[model samples]
Target chain A: EPEVTQTPSHQVTQMGQEVILRCVPISNHLYFYWYRQILGQKVEFLVSFYNNEISEKSEIFDDQFSVERPDGSNFTLKIRSTKLEDSAMYFCASSRRTGSPLHFGNGTRLTVT
Target chain B: AQTVTQSQPEMSVQEAETVTLSCTYDTSESDYYLFWYKQPPSRQMILVIRQEAYKQQNATENRFSVNFQKAAKSFSLKISDSQLGDAAMYFCALSTGANSKLTFGKGITLSVRP
Candidate 1:
């Protein structure tokens, strides 16, 4: 089965440094999303993208966070300046349509020092 | 806004026994979707089952089944003949309206004793 793939299974960065988490969603999926989970916490939605634009975002997805599908295949999330609280497991997900069940990747563990 | 709640933080069941993880959500939209996701120690989140609000019959897959009460806004996952591998963190999620974003519960940790 085709599944979403994320790069840098684990990322370690220092505060004030910029970080980028990359993902390659299923080729045919049109809707993409980014979610995060703190240690032993529930998953929280970050943002959703469709039709080459952001459809919706959560309060946590503030100015420091940005997502881009630079190429047609690779989707990336960039953090302008990392903070200790930015440490978490970031998940990339995609679906064929709005109502379809999302397929998630193994997730990228981001750690800020 | 929609919120999902998993009241039981932890639960345990004997191998070959049965266990149910409770989930409740508050949503104003009549048309929405509910899902149960399992995350093992490997930390890979996998979809277990999904149910549409319009469906009256519960959704089932193999030994995994759901008890969905739309009126009560409850969706629970029932794992029958559970095995040791069934032990994991289970999350309840909701997606409403045209958005593909998912709102997830705090998650329930299930431990299966040998």
Candidate 2:
């Protein structure tokens, strides 16, 4: 079955640095999302993208977080400045329609020192 | 606000026996969707099963099935004839409608005993 694919399975960065996480959603999917899970915590919604723009975002998805559909198949999340608390597993997901079953990527583990 | 809760943090069952994971959600919307997802050591989230709020019939996929109680706002997952490969962290999620964002529970870890 088609699936969401994320690049850089694991990343390590220093505090105040920048990091870019990339994802290639299912080719036919129309809605895309970015979520994060801190160790031993529940998954938190970051942002949702549709029609090539952001639909909704949570407070955790603040000014530092930005998502872009750079191309027809590539969706990317960029963090302007990283902090120690930014360490977590970031998952990219896509669905044929909004709120439908979302297929998730293996996740990119971001570790900030 | 909508919240999904997985009451049990961990559970164990024999390889061939059955096990149930509990989940409860609070949502004001009448129509929504419930989902069960599994994450193994690789941490790849995989869809195990799904249930639509409007449907009364329970959803079953292979040995994985759901006990959905719409009135009580509870959705539980039952794994029958469990296999060793069933060991993983299970998350319960709720979505208000088609094409909506999902709210996930903290997840429960399940271990299948030999």
Candidate 3:
């Protein structure tokens, strides 16, 4: 089955650095999302993207975070400045339609020192 | 706000046996979706089963099935004849509607002993 693909399975960066996480959603999917899981916490929603615009975002998605569908297939999340608290596993997901079962990637583990 | 809770943090089952993972959710919306996802050591989130709140009939996929109690706000996953491969971290998640964000439970770890 087709699935979401995320690059750089593991990312390591110093505090105050900028990081961009990339994802290639399923070819036919229309809705995209970004979620994060702290080491021992529940998976939290970060943002949802549709039609090249953000549909909704959780409080965790603040001014430092931005998502862009630079092209038809690639969706990217950029963090202007990283902090130690930003360390987590970031998952990219997509769905054919609203409320459809979402397909997720293996996830990119971001580690900030 | 919608919240999903997985009461048990860990559970184990013998191979060929059956096990159930409990999940409870609180939601105000009448129409929504509930999902169970399995994440093995690789941490790849895999969809195990899904239930639509509007449908009374439970959702099943092969050996994976769900007992969805809409009125009770409970959705549990049952794994029958479990195999070693079934061992993984299972999560209960909810989405209010289309294009909405998912709220996930903390997740429960399942171990299938051989």
Q: How well does candidate 2 score on lDDT at residue A29?
A: 90
Off by over 4 Å in 3: none
Number of the predicted model whose lDDT against the real structure is largest: 1
* Sliding window of 10 residues with minimal summed lDDT for model 1 chain A: A93-102
* Leading candidate by TM-score: 1
What overall lDDT goes with each candidate model?
Answer: 0.95, 0.93, 0.93
Q: Which digits, one per residue and each the tens of the lDDT, describe model 1 over residues A16-94?
A: 9999999999999999999999999999999999999999999999999999999899999999999999999999999
Tell me the interface RMSD of model 3, in angstroms. 1.1
Candidate 3 lDDT tens digits, B1-114: 889999999999999999999999999998899999999888889999988899999999999999999889999999999999999999999988658578999999999999
Residue-level lDDT of model 3, residues A1-113, one tens digit each, is 78799998999999999999999999999999999999867889999999889999999999999999997999999999999999999999999886798899989999999
TM-score of each: 0.99, 0.98, 0.98
lDDT per residue as tens, model 1, B35-65:
9999999899999999998999999999999
Q: Evaluate every candidate with DockQ and list the scores.
A: 0.84, 0.74, 0.86
In candidate 2, stretches whose alpha carbon ends up further than 4 angstroms from where it belongs are B97-99
| Reference-based lDDT, residue B55, model 2 | 94
- By summed lDDT, the worst window of 10 consecutive residues in model 1 chain B runs over B94-103
TM-score of 2: 0.98
What TM-score would chain A of each candidate receive against the reference chain A?
0.99, 0.98, 0.98
